[model samples]
Target: MFFDRKELTNDQLVTFYRQILLPRMIEEKMLVLLRQGKISKWFSGIGQEAIAVGAALAMQEDEWLLPLHRNLGVFTSRKMPLHKLFLQWQGHPEGYSKGRERSFHFGSKAHHICGMISHLGPQLAIADGIALAHLLAGEEKASLVFTGEGGTSEGDFHEALNVAAVWNLPVIFVIENNGYGLSTPVEEQYRCSQLVDRAKGYGMEGVRIDGNNLLTVYDTIRGVREYCVREKKPYLIECMTFRMRGHEEASGTKYVPAQLFETWGRKDPVVLFENWLMSQAILDADGVERERQRIRATIEEELQLAGAAGPADFTFQDEIADVYAPASEITGEIPGSDRELRFIDAIKEALDEALQTHENLILMGQDIGAYGGAFKITDGLADKYGVARVRNTPLCESAILGAALGLSLEGYKAMVEMQFADFVSVGFNQIVNNLAKLHYRWGQSADVVVRLPTGAGVGAGPFHSQSNEAWFTHVPGLKVVYPSSPQDAKGLLLAAFADPNPVLFFEHKALYRSITGIVPDTAYQIPIGKARQVHQGNDISIITYGAGVHWALEFATAHMEIGLDIVDLRTLQPLDYDAIRQSVMRTGKVIVLHEDTLTGGFGGEIAAWIGEHCFEYLDAPVTRCAALDTPVPFNTTLETQFLPKARLREAIQRLVSY
Candidate 1:
């Protein structure tokens, strides 16, 4: 629970009143515009202005804010220009997202605010990362994140609170209990007596407060901040308030009983604050009207300027633009030592070198610290860099990934290792929706490298053995790197760290110690979206990656008379189409092979592209070899048959014979 609030000065009281009044007036005017068909939509924080206004004013400007749909006061209280916010609201070019997104879905780094995704729970975990940055830098700053009462039910909410409590992050988790999550009542949302009580479960302090009282809000939050910065811990504040309007202006509030409004209406935050100011003789009725007029006139001027900026003109090409950072001019191979290292050791060497090279690098995952992770990839590195750099995380994959994105926002690069590639399913929302879309939607770089120990040779069963790269390759704004051999593994992992987007680095679980190759002693980079020719004969080409690369090379080596050309597609995304085309054109026949299942595999994509582009040159139909459409089996014999190992020879014979 928060400490007792000290009395506020007259100036502080007046400032709070004015800040609370500003959002109320702006929302009121926006309602008129909404009716008149100017603004498209609005999430009215009409009666609950004090929660946003008071919270924003109480926190330092240096602290970051993760705000949701209805918190209009956060933008205004931060002194973000009304005109630009209006442009953002109107989907114009001058806005933060440059009309790439609408509503409050854009963050302003200058104002120290990260916008919320529609999936509200993920932001809770992201706030942990922002607070982690403060902890890393030894700064007093904390991160404040808000979620509705309904959001507390999300898995990310639990993950976030648990992580924050475990790590002792300075995050002020504010839950705005506005009586409804859309149409569902609060009673249906939870069985707990109060949302703030959840803090006890996470081993943190919490307090419920009168959100309608502007003075209480300002003082309580100020005290909460002081306690957070001093104690270096998490605290929850449930602001007890009611929505004065529908969830959005488009959604009517008929579900809300009329009597309920009458009760909550009397406790209106703006009127409560205004009456307090008048009774104290700090302001009068005339002054109130004069202040409203002053704000109203300012709103009009800002609106005119915003409207004058006109709409954002975007073409189809513009939609594709800014989807990724400038493609790395860094291309070609990494020269290596004669010393042979296992695939896993090569990756470990790259990470160890990276920790020494960059100070802002952070490694987070389950058992990744002193325990050295599930596969020992992080072995002894935590001992060298300390657990601060090579950090261990909870079972909450979604929260950890969100935190990685947040850490990136704070000038830090984070590499999160999913113990198994299959576990990425638990955190897909953060990977695809949050990290993959952050830069294109808001121009914020999400420099995260997630090392996914992937593929299906370990007989780890259905849950553990998975080739999930195809799922991510379909998602734009992500770089998917899947390398084969010790050399490419070391080189590409370094390249993944350099690229300014979220990258999925897939490492085969079986290849860790089974295969060894020449690897560079120090750090190096291989160009992503490039391929290498493993075998030179041009009679027929086998396009492959990951475990498939080894499979194809062995088959080509054994069948010397077949005249096979094996092209290793080290990077799955931004596919080395030029290399693919070159192979297809030279051989006049091609086979796409992968460790994943046959249907909807990356093999299907390569085959489709070859058919579409190189049909004229292809002497035969482009063939594909992949595992059967079933879960990876537990038995080694069943798994071997389930994989493409047996199917590749048949695929090669067909393509070569044709």
Candidate 2:
């Protein structure tokens, strides 16, 4: 697809071709660097450089841009130093701190880039939030987010777009259709003929363009950017591009159809753009040769400088750098308010309080406005905070999360919500790759909070019932908190918003209304990464979180004959390993429990850690009680059978007998 020629000039077209070729060479050099053991992994936007550079150039400094992993060219064209990028791949902290070397998967704040998260779809939704924040703050900034065609299939994509369109968010969504998600081709990804066509379902504008043609990509992005800013509507632009290399440095996808690869290579966007530039008389033979020579020298100098830079200070003291919020200085007394509200209501209070306390705080989610959010966590927020601060986003989770990362760099504290925690899988790429590692990779902070209504008891079934704490606990730089009571929920939620690093805050659906406690009236802050001892017993310790905490306590009370101490792990990340060891030391026995499947649940990590650290104190093997490895059955009886319960009367009895 081509844009009408009246839009772009010959000079602009020539520059686009030159920029595309520059990054292509960089990609090839990085590939060689990886093969020679100089770098760990190389992600080159060799074939798709036009789209990245075009969209990036279209964005103004104040406006936001969230690019995907393969968009390093975007950062470079925007003035990111190549040496810094190389240093990042070489595991040098200074490399990322100085330049935009951190865009491999996670983004860098130094360059006004958003936190690069591995989760795919959430960035779209976050873009909605950024647009809303600018509008609400009465600022003249627009927001743009980039993703792949494969990410468009995620439910979060639909959710983000639906919300953004309904609310008329000033956001642009760019789909870089490189044709493959890892090894799965776009044909195998979705039945839809075009990724942009799905925008009709959300009542938004959608267009497909030649991603490799910088003129087309730039014109399309500039139009959408202006529309989002002026009309306050979202746009979906699909840039049909290609990837000329393997999925990752480690991947050798032998399954891709040979014919398809050859066809894509022949229509390479970089070559096509160059050919177009020559046809347009923007460059002669000598000019093209000179431009190529300059790019080569730049690359060589960048590599030399990067190689000269030594390794990072891997000392243990450096580990504490980004662990906690720097401004977490305890203010005297945070008086509690006397509002006896529902769990979701407390969430609203916390969000408002955060926005009031921190100027950077921006909120975005699905149906979160006059619609009051999917669960009303943001009821009346759009009206009160204005459409900018209280943004209702499109259904694209990856984009939402990615945009939040970008918005965060502009010094905005962002809180993006997923309709359900189960749907977080859609944005898993943003979470694992970007949010969790951005601070570490880029040597910058990402103060972002993502709240999801999680857990199974509500009968939401397999799609909505997933308790995904285990999926995130393994990721570094992310703190996972699941509160069982409204009081704990409010306190932990506030704490998460106050954190410097990204956090996953899950409010169990079953506890939102069914449970209530004496929560403080106002913003009562709680420290993260600290476990609360709910009960004391000399016999054994039951370690759990979320819904399981309540059940474990109930089981302990019901079987009072067996003295069981319950440890509520309010924060799953940066786990209180010392507290666990101390509890084990006192009781000489421990049992790990969770609601997720037994195979790869958080319990496995806990059990292994305990086995390694407190093996001598254990009176028995570290036992874990969890749900069976099966999708949450729709039948109540089957769910009950499959779910984890504290009928620990038997386990307790067995432990005592042993």
Candidate 3:
């Protein structure tokens, strides 16, 4: 409780007293409000105010902070508006997430605070991303992240720390060992004697400090921050603190031993700081009460403004509008087509152009540097653009994805390639939870393009080959681009990179080198949602995208007398419904073809859309030609039968006759 650490001036000592008291006082009032049924919930950082407050005073204003839900001291110390902070708790429109998110789960770009989400661990890697951005921009800024002892057990913790150490990124990994992780004690969390001990495994120094001591937290963090920036390396620190209240008011701390509150009460951050302040002659007993009253009055005034905002205004249209950004307005000049290139070459061409054109462009993935990539799609890119721009990452997809999100926050265009589409499952949380919901929750553009080497044909089997585009189309706030040809692949990729949203650009491995088409010599943006009519006919229409387009084209050419029409729906999320309606209306019969298996495949979506919108125009029920509902097999014979290629002809003939 008492610190004999770094010496401070009179005003500095007084400042620490006020900073530590602020969150403690505010949290107490909110708990009262919760008991009175005025507020829904509260995550109390009551006993551990010093760590958050001290870190706030320690880090530079420009330095990025990724704090957990309970660290209200960081917000108040950063001078975040108390009115809006209260509004966030009240779920008012003026809150950080505009009332879209509950609790202190929102961050302020203005304040440079990146709040931790409910999932908790991914933000550690996200902090790495912010630090990585600073490193790339040649800024000496460091990123500080807070995690509880339990959070250290997550795989992201290991990935983030290793990545930071390897890249020499400026990041301060602060573990607030709050003893219990939602009632699971620290002893149960890890077998290690202390969380700081893991730092050596990542080739970094780790320090332990008294989290309850206000002066110690500030002094330790300030010193470590200097070291991080000077050396451009990561440092780990463990703040020994205790959670005074339950994780949330709703979940009572009955599971916590009663003696902990008594024992830790002696080491209370506020009580210790207040006694230390009185010893410094900053305040007496009466002065302490007056200071508390003064802070309470300030909170009350801010609460009035926050309460005036009323409940959040909810509208169905606003919900839909916030899901994804609208189509890009100005799509730059469309250059003429000049050369025929393979699908892989076209994608590489787009990446090459992006690196040349975008100064802040960065390419990150596993084996993407000198060795190129698993398929060599990024071959020679590292040679052309330096290794820094075309970077290889550890086999940690979640961390890399989070880093890309962080870079995007720093106004950089990041392109991340997943070795295989199925491998994306490893980083699925970063995509579906963070990347997909970042803008919709906090109004920040995640301008990242995730290149997916997808589809099944070359017997790469389950892990390597899978048509996983449908997996992302189901999630909002992400644009799903699955181009059919080398030409479309190049234009769509360039367009995906230019668009201000999270995009999953699915590159079918089966077509990457096998297919070649005329591509533009100069980079051009093809509007994402637009579809192109591949073949014109009258009787039956085949609508598809990705590998299915090639099969449909072959069939269209082979059975020219059957009068078949083919349409390639380029982007899945912002589907070209107009094109779909027109095609179904003209042909009267439709066959939705796709490489993904039946049942949950995207073909069902298109067929359902046709049934819903073009019911009257249809001469027969909409048919579907898709792979069997099973994982792609290794055997070529079975793989051929599993795909829609074998079924396309039968489906088209049946639809034409019907």
Candidate 4:
């Protein structure tokens, strides 16, 4: 079928027809499966197939594709296996995501496709990161990101576009303005007359077109991709179309106006294309029928195979198994003999060594370049590596983390620093939802290390001083490490960079300058998931981490007559349960301590674990010592009183008496 033989060859025309037909057939089949309860949900690309297929066909094989949930045609156009799609919908083990995710929440590195998370706007920044990597490597490929009209309302969308424009990243943002976002119409979603007009604010080119016309969509995308590659700039295109079906199969079209559907039905893309093909004598009626039958047979076969596949063999342990780096992979030699070093100096040394060791390592944070970091941890790094490697970013925390995820996905390791751990709440979605679940959902490695300067003791108020390690410890896929000494700080930082997953490295603000110990100059990794017994005793065991380690040591020194064992847990998520059990079993009395608030601190988790597993071996109830359940005060006296030291001593005295 070739209506315009001069513009496109007969083969190209046939490919377009096949692309359109595949998604249409697949959409119909998915609806049938939904009715039969073979699939839990179905998102149709009925009237919107042209946008997805056209954009996919226009991009080069090396270019990346980040498609939204409704873009089924992108997968088909990328030559993704039909049976795998069925298996994914059926939640079978052999699927792309290995049955971990239910629907279109997976990506393929082999195919240059970035996966989509439920939070739509976050992917926009991630797409920018992919484009930034290509730009940095001198690659000609651009990244294509898809989103709906509703997603544009999110702050991430604006942040990504603005950064892409400022940096001139080669990214193409395609927004399918399908008239409605779920149930809300476009008029209610935005006050602007046209979404493309917003591009002027970011100093980027914007276009609006008829999304129903396959040829127009294909031409526009191809032109934009070439322009972006040549100019190293971002482009935005708003495709005007309608969602013929419901948001999902379960959400019917009752919310949509019947007259609007009736009006759009007359301009159906498939029907118009078929009529044009027949009019041009490129395809006869019999030829159209044959193509439809062939697609139907292919879908049926895949569906049957997918239906017969077994469920995934998943367990709770699998979700948390790979949180920390394996010990074998962390092996390395220490260069120089041990020398006394401050904790802050040790952290700086680790960064300096890591940057020199790994060529792909890049450092990113606010004021981290020539100005150094907020705490000078990354000072003089930009002077050594230049601004390209040690770059300073904006105040957008979410986009910064999202960009890190994108860079990690493209085979680069990123060492990102949050100015303070308290501000991490701004980027919580990217950390908890995107960074934590990437590997669990699709086996994607987010080799990113986030340095969170945490804890209180510095006269900084509620916004600057807060111990938030307990928040991350609760997440299954994150590796939480808080070091108490200079040696562990240096070693753990190195290990965290070597790890192939996201590691939340919590550096206590109070310990950074106040603590000093011998640290090796050479590269080395302290084994993760192992606790060190600083002192051994027969009376009671004190389990603690971060700055609490120093406090526990002080408490034990004063109470030598009571006899105490000090267990310093450097790693939190993949905790050293064996060490905890052995220490508690020997002492027969346990007390968990932390700097976080007492209500839901990590000490509760430690106490719960001990009570559940070591109840019979214990001589008394497990005691927890943590800060009072109140915001850290600005006054030094109140802050000291609010902490866990007095409470810890009281608990120790009570446990000894018991």
Candidate 5:
């Protein structure tokens, strides 16, 4: 419990004792409440309190912090209301909704707390990207990312660390090594005795500190953070702390060895600091009591406010309102689009027009510059706009998404591309957890567009041929748009670029060259969350989107006897419920199709929506045609069979006969 380190000042030690104890007591109370069933679940940062508070105190106001789930000390110190934290545990919508975020994922634009992410390790990569943004903006600030020892094992940790190291980014990577990762000890998880060594692999100096010693924790972080800011070089610090409680309140402590807890108990961070304070004669009995009383009062007041603040009133209707751009409210018809152009050209023209219109917009991705793009959509952009605006990034998907988020925060409209939609999984967390939730967390809007080449037909297999819209559609903050034809692609890309929040724009490779349609050269934007009726018939409502829309229309048109009403849902997130409901009401029959697997696909969501909202309109059970639940095979014949195609014709024939 005692510390041999002498780097910490007397004042810093006393401050740590005062700040950490209050949060620790509050955490203890919540843990009890969780056991009593009054609180839903609790993820307490108990034994690791000293390091958290110390590090948070060392951080500057402008520096960004991307916190993980176990960030009580960090949040509390940063003025997060404890009541809101409690409300979050109680599952009240207002809990996370009180701030820009809807849960324990607290952050503030004013505070420069980028936000907290529940995912294990991707936040580290985000921190790296934010740091990159700060350096590029020529700001005198850095970014700090805090994670546990287990998080170091994730691929994101490696990617972010390397990027930061290579670029000499203004970032500090702090590893809270609390011995066990959900009951698995450090010995089982890693081969090295110290986690700091892991940072060495990334070409950064890594330091090991006695985390339980408040003075050591504070001094180490404060020193390294300053070094990063001045030197613009990332550093890693391993905080050797321990967990006094279970991972979450729902997880029983029976799995953890009592002996391990006993071993760590001797080095209890709070007790160590209190004893050290007394030993240093920094404070007498009255001083310690006053500090405790002050913290307790602050926590009690916040908790009272949080308990009375009721749940969020926002509903699914709120989801429909914000899918498009905030500044440009171009709603009527597609602008200057009476004539037609190629989809690829439409995409290029849209980008060119958007860049000229908005000075904040930037295009970034691998080979998107002079090469135009992997698909030649961004060709001639670099020459016209300059290389700085149309950036060619390293072949790292996570970094690309992270960089996009950083740029978006700084009022830049960033359009990042994944060479293929299947490759988007590489940056999935940054897209889903961070970029999607930016507006939700800090209430700060991030205008980011992720353009991805999706679907199959050109001999690309599982890795290259994927319609991953379903993955993003399920996420709360993102808006997914899959355009069927070239015109729609142009309109949708422009709309996505203009959107205030994050947009995952999916472009089908099959339609890139094969299915040509007309698009105007002038500025144009397609309305998001609106489905166009491609064909109007009385028999059935075949709702589809993206490349699948073509198949749905072909099958419907081929069968003259069974007329169909085909609705193309251009935007997946803010689904065109009005169009869908109208079609279902008129036809009284429904069929949903997509290029993804049927299980947990977007079609299931559409079917469920129709079942809930238009059950009476149904003539028979709603049928869904989706790709089989297997990887896209390399063989052309197998790929054809795997996708949702003319099989819908057979379904329509059977339905008409019935």
Candidate 6:
């Protein structure tokens, strides 16, 4: 039953008063710091503190909280050390994000709180993933996610809700509909009379409440939590409130109407709750004043401590620490017998072994469950591991990737599959902005491996076929793996899962069925940033990866007279510079080849690296052979001409005869 304001005990009222007061005092102190040149920026939740406090208090200690920058009251209610919050504001090394992020861009694993990125709505899907984890683990806990009215308009918001509804996930989505979305009023944003009304479309229960009413906010969220836990369903609560202050400390209240502030100013949540307490004789005016003084003193001391704590000494090495897994983890060579298998089967076997070994590993993709993915690469995984671990998701690429990030945060390693590499563009924002930057931004490990079925040989057109490894290679925090042989494919995937960072595993569609090699039956991992010298010779150096490796091997075997030193770069991000240098120095000539467009393929990166580091060892200008600057055609003749073996052979001959 929902509790009335009068029903709350004296201790409960006093506790709520303190929870609301803490964030108010903190925001006020931060504004002072902003003017004093001590802090950089501040996003205050001055008038909306009640919503944060109420929702946080309603949730259990173990239930996860996905909070936005304006939800400081939630942190206060959760008993997050005030000094840590101050340290975060000061960007101290001891802060939750380890001095990497600013403001509220921090999370605590101990507290079960997932920090948010500036791109607001992605957290919605991430919260769903956390809820999914809870469901899979049979944990009786729900995830409480906070977003604003502006965030509701984002595509991820709808996608998160839809997925939660379809899967019956336990999540309570709270929308703090505080009149303005960074100066753009609600009426200008969406025409709906009430934001809660949109929940009908997503098949979830929706409720609206006066956000300034602390009792109502807390009771509503408490009830929602019960319903979610009991029914395993998602709920949305739209709290009506106003932004009394500007978006940030630097932004003045000029954009906000003077009348609106004056109207909301009278309905201040802290003052209203305090007045109710006094009316009930729970706490007199003097008691409230004493409480305020105590909070002010506490905040002052915490801020002083934080100010004394200096900034962290961050080096470039620290910034890129999690880019690749530690070499020590690979240990000795993989001990096992070899079995001849197709490239597709090798990848499936690797996934099966990983699932069988690690309880935290999960596979998610479209058609991966019943249909066994687009290429049947994950054919029997669902049947073996059950649908929960091997999940089939809706055609929401961005949401799927965002959920993978959340799953990673919750200590699960997610292997997400993009049916085709070209479709990765649809989810490019999450991959680059969220997945790639998590480690760099907050020192948070994104243990996600995105399996992309890439490249073209069959009659698949532009939408189905693409070689987009270069895009991920450019991202600093991501590890790019494209294996040519079945052995490398199986080994590298195992390495990726073991790594702490995000890895983009590019599985060339052309090599799936056509390529077969001996793969170890026992569990093993190939080192991520090392290259294999497939063929050793001294005349010319052939640098290639993925399907291009096969082409290079074919050409080198055909022309035995020309000694070719072929280097197959299994990992693209951390290129084997030592191997490349030695081969180029010995051969004195180099040929870079790939299936991507010649203009901006990863080959260009290889050529540039060689030019910068191996310039003295060069005998001839480095030559690069790649696909023509056009989309892959549907016609077989044109497709064959598009990826010409003769072109690569001619380039090799020119380099060899140089």
lDDT score of residue 355 within candidate 6: 95
By lDDT: ranked, best first = 1, 3, 4, 6, 5, 2
* Predicted candidate 1 versus true structure: per-residue lDDT over 10-54, tens digit per residue: 677777777888888888888888889877988888878878888
On lDDT, the leading prediction is 1
lDDT of each: 0.89, 0.77, 0.88, 0.87, 0.78, 0.87
TM-score for candidate 5: 0.85
Clashes of each: 0, 59, 0, 1, 13, 0
- Per-residue error at 154 for model 3, in Å? 0.9
- Model 5 residue 96 lDDT score: 51
Q: Please give the range of 10 consecutive residues that has the lowest summed lDDT in model 6.
A: 319-328
Tens digits of per-residue lDDT for model 3 on 111-202?
88876678888998888888889988889889999999999999999999999999998999999998999989988889988889999999
TM-score per candidate: 0.97, 0.76, 0.98, 0.96, 0.85, 0.96
- Cα lDDT of model 6 by residue, 398-418, tens digit: 888988887887789898999
lDDT of 4 by residue, 1-658 (tens): 2233348865677678889889988988888888888789887889888899989999997788999888888899999889988888888768888777868888888888888988899999898888878877888989999999999999999988988898798999999999888899998999999999999999999999888888888889999999999999999999998999988778888999899888778767777777777777778899899989999999989877776776567676755553433335555555566689999999999999999988888888899999989999889999999887898988888988888888887788887899999999989999998898887777788888999999889888788889998888888678889889999999989888888888999999898889999898777888767788998898999999998899989977887797788899999977999999999988999989899999989999899999999998999999999998999889989888888975887898899889
Task: List CA RMSD, all candidates.
Answer: 1.9, 5.3, 1.4, 2.1, 4.1, 2.0
Candidate 6 global CA lDDT score: 0.87
Q: Which residue pairs in model 4 clash with each other? A: 335-522
lDDT score, candidate 5, position 366: 85
